[model samples]
Target: MIKMRNVTKYYPNHSEPALAEINVDVEKGEFIFLVGPSGSGKTTFIRLLLREILPTTGEIYVAGIDVLHLRPWKVPYLRRNIGCVFQDFKLLPNKTAEENVAFALEVLGRSQHVIREQVPEILKLVGLESQGHKFPSELSGGEQQRISIARALVNHPPILLADEPTGNLDPATSLELMALFDRINKMGTTVLVATHNREMVDSMRKRVIALENGRIVRDQVRGVYGYED
Candidate 1:
């Protein structure tokens, strides 16, 4: 689960905050969508959860760890519990799909045997079993993104955070990716996606949280991407 109360973040020399007076609580195994236009604090929200930046005033607890007071050396431990996917695929060009996923586990010092077992299974889970031998450049946009998702999920993180994950794909591919995300959520991983994809959000009809001017304007259990901007 995740909790944030009265959270506010401000950068130096900025007249306004990047995030302000935010309050959110996400339960385990839930699928949530954060819908907003650019500069609406969506990225800031994700960064805060990752402890990439501290809120100027507030409390944040993710997966039961007090992120604010968490020690520098323990940041990695907190990140281990959360999987993240970004707009860009961010794959290693030199590594094949299988190797790309294996690298994540390798960072945790997982044994070669474990990596071998996990890499193939994750590729299969992402519907890229045969493509494992291919490099990122050899794969299509969707496949590359799926590999990124596979890398993020290979460790079985309890929480998944995706920021504009479908920004680059075509509609068909985006829907396919969203379907994969839905399946992952059903498998018990809490999924929080920040995107402005109105069509996708309306179709999913999951919990929707809207942000604008760094403040949450709406929280609907079953909501759509209703903002026109």
Candidate 2:
């Protein structure tokens, strides 16, 4: 559902491109991992998908929509098809878990009745039904992250993009989260998780797209983590 061709991104004042000559096609319902060290363009690729930054060159298509040709007014519409999670759970501090997940549907102008019906289902899917009333500060790191995931997925988005999602958690919690992602993928949502967690990547043995210095070095099915210590 994602296609990139010779994609390159250069930030102002940077001597080199953040992403260089990227080309890949990720099909629907596929679960993929973006594995890279810091500054290797994993975040850049995510931003490109989200249209947070424009590519300096090349093209991108998500679900057959040409990202480069999208009108300014259509950006939000494009994002509606994508669910994103980041390393620092970007939940509103004051909002409860249910409210946070509901907020996503609300922003889409979904009716209150729809929000009421969908929010709890998403929370339950993410394993946060019991804590929906708790604020982010009141929850454990893993719980907070799960809430974030719930918010992202509440819209039943076709593609889920997670960046460094397990960064702040302990191994056990990270494993739990990864298992949750696996479940999400199994339900037919395309999943792309960008992370540097070698152990988790190795254990999962999913498709790995390894990046180094803004270039794809490896793309393997049931791939092991290949970066050296």
Candidate 3:
């Protein structure tokens, strides 16, 4: 569902590229972890896939749309194929979890009836059905993240990209979230998480792509975190 070839991204006046010669493929329904220390280009990798910034050189395809050459006006359509979760919950303070989730569909011009139906289902999927009425501030850190996950999935995007998803949670909460991600993947959505949570990565033992200094150093099947965090 994701393919990259010789991708290189250089920023203005930076002596080094953010990502260098990246080539990788992620199959549909697969769960993959992007393991790296800070400034190791994991975020850069996701940004490239999202086409938030153009790669200096190389090719990228997400769900078969050529990201590098996609029309600017069509970027939204491309993004509809991918869900994004971040370290920060990024929820609107005033919006309840259900409204936040419904907002995603609303932006897509979905009918109120559709939003009403889909929003509850997505909340339930993330184990947040009982907390839908709560705002981000009213929820626990893990609960807020679950709401974020629900919002991201309300569109049923084929691919889910998470950057430092477990960064702000406790270990037990992080484990719970990871289990939710595993469940999501089993239901046939491709899941790619960029993280520094070695315990979570090691315990899950999924396909791991390790990055350092803007390059892929290891891509292993059923891999552990392998190195110290």
Candidate 4:
């Protein structure tokens, strides 16, 4: 579903590329973990897929669309096929969980009828059905993260990209979140998570891709978190 060929990204005036000679393929319905140390290009890799930043060299394809060459005006169309979540839980402080999820579809021009139908279902999917009326400040870290996941999935995007999704949670909460991600993957949404939680990665035993110094160092099926803490 996603392919990158010799992809490299260089920031302006930097001596080194953030990513170098990266080639990877992610098939539809696969759940993968991207594990790497700080500055190892995990975020760069996810940004490339989201087209948040253009690559300096090589090709990128998402769901068969040539991402590198896609026009700026067409970027929204591309994003409609991908959902994103981050460690920070970027939710509107004033908006309730239901409103936050509804906001995503609202921006996509989905009608009120559709938003009403989808918001509750997605909230329930993320195990937040009863908490949808609460604002971000009213929820715990895990609940907030679930709200974020609900918002990301409300559009029913085919691919979900999460960066350090459980970074701020306790071990039990992180495990719970991981189980939720597994459930989502089982429901046929391709899931890619960039994380530093070693225990969670090892326990999950999903495909793991390790990056270091801007290059892919290991790609293993049913892999553990192979790096030292």
Candidate 5:
């Protein structure tokens, strides 16, 4: 669940807000797509949810926590409730797939027993059960992305935010990745993806939130990608 009310974000010394008068509500267990052109505030939207940057004006709530007012020291606690995936597949080059996923829990000070139990199960959930021993360089782009997804989900965060998750892959690979996302959503994680892939958006037909000039232009259920390429 994410809610934003009259949210606007302005960068320092900038004449315009990166996001303006944005209001959105994402219920638990929903899969949604955020589609917009470059500079349209998709990244800004994600950053706001993650509390990576504070909004200049308005309110934000994720999973019932008031994000805007959350203390800096409490940010980590907020992050623990949300999983994030990025386009770069930010895997450690030297670590195996299992290690990368396990490291997330390890950083949170999870016990070795818990790490061992959760890592393999998450890898299997992401269709990487056998590839856990492989290094990032040894895996295909899709496989590496799957590893990233496994890492994100190992904690079973209630919300998953992915920004341009398929930007680096081929069409088939993108489809595969989307299917994986769908599977994750089915398991009760709220999914929000910010992407530019028109065909992917159209085919998936999920909730579509279109942004332009830092404002929400359209919010539709089962919507196609409506902008021209």
Candidate 6:
């Protein structure tokens, strides 16, 4: 669950705010899309969630932890409960797909035995079991993205944040990726995806929170993509 109340973000020396008065409440098992045009503060919203940037004003609580007041030492622990995916596949080029996912667990100090067992299961979950030995350059865009997803979810984080996840893919591949996210959501993970794909948004009929000019213009259950294209 995540909550943001009257949150505003202002960059230093900027005359205008990047995010203005954002207030959102997401339930534990909800799947929501954050849709908007470029520069609409979708990425800012996610950075706030990840604690990559702090809010200039207002409060943000993620999974009942006060993100605004979180200690620097505790930030890593907070992130352990959440997973994130981005448009660019951030995999290490030298590592194979399974190694990439397992690396996430290894960073958390998980045992090698545990890493070996869990990594394959997660790779399979993301439909990339056979691609485990492949390097990043060897896989297609979609496959590489799935590897990233596997890395993010291998920890079984209760929440997942994806920013422009399908941005670089073709329409058909984008749909397939969206279906993967849907399946992940159905397995009880809270999913928040920030994207600009109107067709996919309309077809999914999921909860949508639309932002424009740094403000939420619409919050609808089973919402269509309502903004002018």
Write down the TM-score of every candidate.
0.99, 0.98, 0.99, 0.98, 0.98, 0.98
- Once fitted onto the true fold, the runs of candidate 4 whose alpha carbons sit more than 4 angstroms away are none
Could you tell me how far off, in angstroms, the CA of residue 62 lies in candidate 5 after the best superposition? 0.6
How accurate locally, in lDDT, is each candidate? 0.96, 0.93, 0.94, 0.95, 0.95, 0.93
Q: Which residue pairs collide in model 2, if any? A: none
Record all residue pairs in model 1 with backbone atoms less than 3 Å apart, i.e. clashing. Answer: none
Please give, for residues 1-229, the per-residue lDDT of candidate 4 as tens digits: 9999999999999999999999999999999999999999999999999899999999999988999889999999999899999999999998998999999999999999998898999999998899989989999999999999998998989999999999999999999999999999999999999999999999999999999989999999999998898
What's the true lDDT of residue 82 in model 5? Answer: 94
Off by over 4 Å in 2: none
In the range 1-229, model 3's lDDT, one tens digit per residue, is: 9999999999999999999999999999999999888999999999988989999999999999999789999999999999999999899898898899998899999999899899989998998889988888899999999999998999999999999998999999999999999999999999999999988998998999999999999999999887874
Report how far residue 44 has shifted in candidate 3, in Å: 0.3
RMSD of 2: 0.8
Worst 10 residues of 6 by lDDT: 220-229
| lDDT tens per residue, model 6, 132-165 | 9989999999999999999999999999999999
lDDT by residue for model 2 (1-229), tens? 9999999998999999889999999999999999988999999999999998899999999877899999999999899999999999999998888899989998889999999899889888888789999989999999999999999999989999999999999999999999999999999999999998888999999999999999999999999889896
Models, CA RMSD each: 0.7, 0.8, 0.7, 0.7, 0.7, 0.8
The 10-residue segment of model 4 with minimum total lDDT is 149-158
- Taking the tens digit of each residue's C-alpha lDDT, what string does model 1 give over 1-229? 9999999999899999999999999999999999888999999999999999999999999999999999999999999999999999899999999899999999999999999899999899999999999999999999999999999999999999999999999999999999999999999999999998888999999999999999999999999999886
